[model samples]
Target: MTELARAAAADPAAATSPEPVPTTPDGVPRGQPVLDRLVALLDLERIEENIFRGVSPAESPVRVFGGQVAGQALVAAGRTVPEDRHVHSLHAYFIRPGDPRVPIVYEVDRIRDGRSFTTRRVVAIQHGKAIFSLSASFQLREHGLDHADAMPEVPDPESLPSFADRVSEYGARLGDMAKLPRPIDLRYVTEPAFLSRESGPRDARHQVWMRADGSLPDNDLLHVCVLAYASDMTLLDAVLVRHGVYWGLDRVIGASLDHAMWFHRPFRADEWVLYDCASPSASGGRGLATGRFFDRDGTLIATVVQEGLLRIAS
Candidate 1:
């Protein structure tokens, strides 16, 4: 077993749970429980051909994690596409916060089906109001011109400890931040947690190695959903750290505003994918960051862009 695999095996949360059944008989484990719970709580039921209604849990807050809805919506859309065609890109906007106490309906519109591509449009609604919308594209694998920019060299995933270790060491100092859901194993390459105090202007780029905590099936759609879940982990934080604002700092209040991603090539989430990210600007209480994902062989597999609300506490 790999060191990461060992670390995951040692984790109580990961080790104790019964193996999760995939959404479909042949599907893979998508491993985002909060998302799974949201899907279950919403009691997603098919209302029309290729259309799904997602009801939210009464226990959740109205404004949902944009990533959760986006990932789930992608799954809903992927279910309609052919197995060979994998999602290549997705763009979405959070028009409003979804009320968790109520159900959010997801409607998938099949826009086009071509020899090599399929497009889908999704609208998420709450209380008879549109709350979020997304457009996603899928592509059939084919031989094509292939080249990728060089992967940024960073510390290997083996050199860093699991995030859980860091949190256990810090204990109560991390408070609620420590309890954030972490379905993927993450290890920082650029900024080790120990250097936060000795820093000057921080490096704009950040890289992490990640994969699902459990074995996943061979379906491509499950990998896409897992990518969507892991994508939200730390890209925007690169923007904040560029200015030296760690999460616990008194003045920082950051939340993701919008997220977009494009898959460039085929890759497995079970393997280490280096998330190379950088921040371009931060002004007017918002910051933007972009990232590229590269497999172990340096194949560029995806690109991600996100903007977040960064505010100073009064």
Candidate 2:
């Protein structure tokens, strides 16, 4: 077994458990448990060498979430490379909407394997056509000039109300918000961008504390992939905040155009990290946003940038 696999085996949380009903801080039962389902979502089924199949959990029926494909494609690429080489960067583009009713097939291309760095390209296919494509770079451990921006001052995660609590505050207008699968527990430090029907005087930035709802194995790849999955949850919300448009509240339509991420340090998905996000610009029906993920002690773990198509119906 690989050293990383051994580490995962050592983690007690790797053991399977019965699924539980999801609930909020106020004990309102909502949907099925999420951690196990998330694990299943990431566990791609290897069909053949360099090819893998992944399925989405039964959550939103409209379309497969973009993050799921990105994470699974990373997993497919990681399987082809050695465990010692960790992923440092990835760039991906969504070509078409994924059909959640069907499984997605990922094909990994062995682009290059160098002594110091490795490169991989992954294509996600459904309906015999490419739905998404990604290129990732991996590197061996090496020390470099260490510099990062300081984590911004914000209320501790524990001090804020859970996302479940915030959603419950919306009451019936948002429907059964708790019924949605929430694998990552998010605590907003400010009023959620979707709360108001009109744009306020607030800036086009947001901060939230998030972590996997349950413990995960010690596998480094899994942890990174999980973070990739969670990163997409609210990054684009920064753009919506600027226009005072809530996805469900207004006649707004949006889809991620592309995503890019850089891993600066090793971090666990089960631990609290603050995600600070802002939209620098929006024009010609597209909006660009950037974010920084910081650990509880103010250590920068990762940075993300994404551009998405945003249009509000007249």
Candidate 3:
């Protein structure tokens, strides 16, 4: 038997008959079609007791986006866990570029289960090769000492131009990209990386307001997964903006190497959260970025750190 099948066979909890699952979670809001696709993306299919399958959007880019895999892997891990337990942290590595044309299979291994904490490791595979892996820890509700960094002052998200409005100046230059589905609403507190490239080099820090485009079902894991999907949307930009470089505009090709996140305090992904991102250092063709999510009331919600491989041409 396969190692995963043996593991499932060995566990009484997993040996029981499996239940039916839907491609997308129930009560998926439909008013926002793009967001609907995103919601459907996270709802993985239960391939077996310990394996799940996910698909990329039909309009996926050349390669699968890192965030999509991370979020889907987390959803796979979360599915093997209890609803009462909430994921507190996750660490992931991108081993290889994912192929958007095929299905990605997620294999979940129950690492540990304690009274207070549960952990699972997920491997995303395609063509019988591991493309990505993630380990996540879940914790039951508990009271403990608490402290966090104060949030930075930023203009209201409503005051800032919507992503489309802000990028309208690029017009024909952005072309098809401008018409793409945006499941997450973005509001930059300052000039976005590309716009700043035009303005000239400046600081290493920038902030943006982020949230799901529409209402989400009342599920903690789904919310966290959505935020995970959104995290990669502009994290690499933090690195590029530091040197005033852009993707197509500059001779630069970069990919996310690893991603880590720690969730703190309960928050809704549908509600606006200020994402403060900055790159601390760049060397050896790699750049590292750190980000913190804060709610409208300035309460810290989550923290993220990512490193990417950036090959820049002189």
Candidate 4:
């Protein structure tokens, strides 16, 4: 078995039964859609005027996914601002790995409320300690000079194999790793970052087409926050792609140190978005990656930069 398969099989709680059908807001059980589950995960329950509590889904057993906290914190920050204002940018730091068993309390601080722009700071507390922090800026819609790098021409998303298909191709090597619930439908344009355990090209740059597994509502904030959650899914893979190392296969330990994103234009999280990612540098046991999100028509929607702690065991 491949190292990844062995690692997955080592976790007794890894492979659970399929998720039960979940009822929607309309009170109809339409099955457990990945997108709906993601939306529910981000939906914070108001605890106080400025404090909201978010829970990690039972599906994630250990540490809470950093993206979930970041997205939920952004949602908390957004809730305190005017509905007309839209998030323009966000910067966040992963203070500590969150304990999934506990609920995270998000405290939103109204940093500034300007006529044209507003800013909010949020702290995610767990076990009476700050585990994450974020600062986001919002602005009213306004016209501005616009230009962006053209999206590279690549195979359409429909032409690429789904992540499950690729994993299945490995047969028994991947074991039940293939059964892990995928919230995003990812279609890799090149060899996947995790497939480096076998023979493959070592390319620092990568591209993938991704979208929510199911349709989302028409809420703009929901879409943006969903993208925020998706953004963390693959960016660090660029670093592994560079060294030809897979996370579980190569004994590589990694976690996001900080994340930043700038919204460039409007986007729909449920639509096919091309994630163009590259690792510009890796040193001191850390790697930096940048990515651009583009719509099907090649319109740049957002740009993200992240630094991660990547250590390889000898």
For each candidate, the alpha-carbon lDDT, in order, equals 0.70, 0.85, 0.85, 0.83
Instruction: Mark the regions of model 1 whose C-alpha exceeds 4 Å error after superposition.
Output: 1-16, 19-45, 54-63, 169-171, 192-200
Which whole-number lDDT from 0 to 100 does residue 194 have in model 2?
Answer: 69
> What lDDT score is found at residue 280 in candidate 4?
90
Model 1 vs. true fold: TM: 0.80
The lDDT, on a scale of 0 to 1, for candidate 3 is 0.85
Q: Write the per-residue lDDT of candidate 2 for residues 103-139, one digit (tens) a residue.
A: 9999999999999999999999999999999999999
User: What would the per-residue lDDT of candidate 1 be over residues 158-200, giving only the tens digit for each residue?
Assistant: 8887666655655356565555554576777777433453474
- Global CA lDDT of candidate 2, please? 0.85
lDDT by residue (tens digit), candidate 4, 236-265: 988888888876567888899999999989
Per-residue lDDT of 168-286 in model 3, one digit per residue for the tens? Answer: 67645655555556778899997798788887777888789999876666667878999999999888788888788887777888999999999998999989999999999999999
Residue 28 of model 1, lDDT score: 20
Q: Which pairs clash (backbone N, Cα, C closer than 3 Å) in model 3?
A: none
Model 2 has how many clashing residue pairs? 0
User: Among all windows of ten consecutive residues in candidate 3, which has the lowest summed lDDT?
Assistant: 21-30
Candidate 4, backbone clash total? 0
RMSD of 3: 8.1
